[model samples]
Target chain A: MLATAAAAIALIFLQQAPAEDIDWDAEFGVEERERDPATGEFPVDPYEKSNANAGAEPFANGRLAAAFGGREGIRRIAERTVELSEADPRIAEIFVAHDTVRLKRTLSEQFCYLLGAGCDYTGRDMRATHDGLGIRTADLNALVENLQQAMREAGVPFAAQNRLLSKLAPMSGDVVER
Target chain B: MRTPCVATGLMLAILSAQPAHADDLEWFEGGKLVLTNGVTTIEGTSGGGIATWATIAGLEMDNGVGVSGHATIIELPDYGWQSHGVAVGIANRVELSYARQNFDTRDVGTALGLGEGYVLNQDIFAAKLRLLGDVVYGDPLLPQVSLGVEYKRSLDGDVAAAVGAARAEGLDYTLSATKLFLSRSVLVNATARLTEANQNGLLGFGSAAGAGHSLQFEGSLGYQLSRRAVIGAEVRTKPDNLGLGEDDWFDLFAAYAVTDNITVTAAYVDLGSIATFEDQRGAFLSAQVAF
Candidate 1:
């Protein structure tokens, strides 16, 4: 036992001697990320952007956009939806680890583009954005309710709200991972 | 014999190799939107007050189990009706339900040589399977559709037979389609049923001669007045097998979601005639809770 203690002390010293030469973070595959100063969002790997990334076709006319209170209203609804989902008990856990700031901006852009409120969507594709989140059908529905609440609060007509829903409803195949 | 033995060994090995995976399964997660599960019908299934829709019975979503219950009352000029039931929804896909219904014959029973205030009772058990589409998702034009089966047993066997009914038990098969066009704030449901029931099996099944299956139709249209309120109307056509002048049924109804889990419905119903009594029109009221 005494010899074993001496050997253990020697092993510790030997391990510490090489610490300065070890690229610990790289060895562990940890990639350091910096938040963009202007956007307060960490950079993601580059991906091609297209309107198709929004996962739905935009409205042909401004009628639907007008009903949603134009670009400002769409932005408000998207931000409010993100806020509500983050606070909701049924789905708060899924949003906790994600950068909500980026989510708000992308969601706002997606909504504005889909509603034809005169904005280009620069967010990641729906499937790529939600990949690996293990989101289930129930989680998708929970987010849908949060969006509905936001739209209702914005005083959008029920029919007009449904019009937007019709566009996004089919994207469940991409958003739901479970 | 060698092949059979090898297959059996393989099956046993596969079964024994399986791991306990209960932790991966989710249960009882209630996240369906308000009133999306629909109200319980008279037969205990999810639907409008008088007709069953393609929607399931509980507030559970695609990965949860949900349960719901309801109590209903209806007043006619010559009779009283009451029913209570419970239902279970599985993964928002399948539903099982049971209901107990009572038909009160205030003075009509005495007139028919039975005691005053005699009541007829029946028990109904039903199961529904959603086949395709969704009420609130996917293609807006493709409505939710389902198939269902209902089994009814009457408590008054002797009375039912005496009243020219072929039997005291029967079955009903139904196919339904429903859609909620949220943009229009309108919801529509249509159902086709094959049945042998008389007065919904409260009186009994079939003709006295034992010949009785018929096709029927139920249609409902609803308009959303608010997030939690809807006004609708329904019409159901029944076979006049008993020749008791049982005319088609119609009702105008309004439903309100009092909370995320409770709903109340009231309607004015017209039954046309029953047991030789004409103009059996009155009021209907129902309350339900789900989670």
Candidate 2:
């Protein structure tokens, strides 16, 4: 009888444990996966769905590349964006020391790579690239406006433009220093 | 009274001084999410239909001011309520609001010896100041906090006296906290209020049964479906000092932003009992325009 009462008391305490103890990911249809016990990090898998580009539509890259009118078309968008940035007073200050032609090429490569056009991005990461520039919200908005205008002039569809912008939006955390 | 009007005049003066482009300063920027900032509460504070939250009224960028106006109508089986108000947010830090509410007694007035179609009018003047944290970008462990006060005055002192009310006016002081989990697209708000208002000051301040204030709570949870739409639920606990057996209030609502300047909200509300009327289920509709 004593042992049975002790087991019953233990059962009640287990039931009263905090709800956060439950593994929510496992309950929410995530596949069974292994994680390092020490770091609680999943093993790196290049082709995993939970990769760096998880939330983006799988076919967005090809669709965006096609929408931007192939390789030459992508290059036109980059050139126009760079030209506008250099002319726009709000953003021109940031590009005063940039090598225009190389910057344009790097932007084109980055855009193509993001759209899954099979091009390698040789530019620095967004955080490192924008570091110490003292970019403000207004400056970011100006840059986005210029990019949108360039895309419009390049004849990219609005939907495709937004698809790319959505992916780029998260980078604001890293790109804006203040 | 003079202060609110003066503030409004000052805001108008500043608005007229700015260029047309400056009006567009309320656009979402720097990781601010659209519609995540709740619309004007019934009392004209920034929040959902019934509860007040800690957020400012507009989509204004940090250090910018935003102003908003709202009109709300609620249709219950036994009563009708309408409210109109204006609110100003300064630097996303402080909020000043004023709302005038009219509660149509309908048949309830006639049954109580008053003429049919009688209306009870009330004025609510409110002010809220953000004290700590940001709802979206501040520390994840801590929510945005604000302290506010609503001074409500009932226009019908005779009616309130007839109903055994102790006073025709009262003050509600509240402390609210709001948090938004951006990645999950969820927002939660909780508010604690100390008040003596009976039926939110529409019936009156305190009742003959009790003149002391009671602590109450209001909470809300919302899920963002898109950049422009949010669906949410709110529950508000009320003080029962009136002896009229008032129950809690509950609502489920959806708000959609037509643009940065305009928003519309519709909800199903259960206000329980009021002044002997039971089961006050109804519909609520509100439209707001903000700069």
| Cα deviation of A57, candidate 1, in Å | 2.6
For candidate 1, write residues A32-141 as lDDT tens digits. 88889999998888899888899988988777999999989999999999999999998899898898989999999999998888888999898899989988877888
| Model 1 CA deviation exceeding 4 Å by range | A1-23, B1-27
TM-scores for the candidates: 0.88, 0.64
Chain B TM for prediction 1 = 0.91
Locate the minimum summed-lDDT window of 10 residues in model 2 chain B: B23-32
Best by DockQ: 1
Task: Give the CAPRI rating of model 2.
Answer: incorrect
Query: DockQ numbers for every candidate?
Result: 0.32, 0.02
lDDT top scorer: 1
C-alpha RMSD values across all candidates: 6.7, 22.6
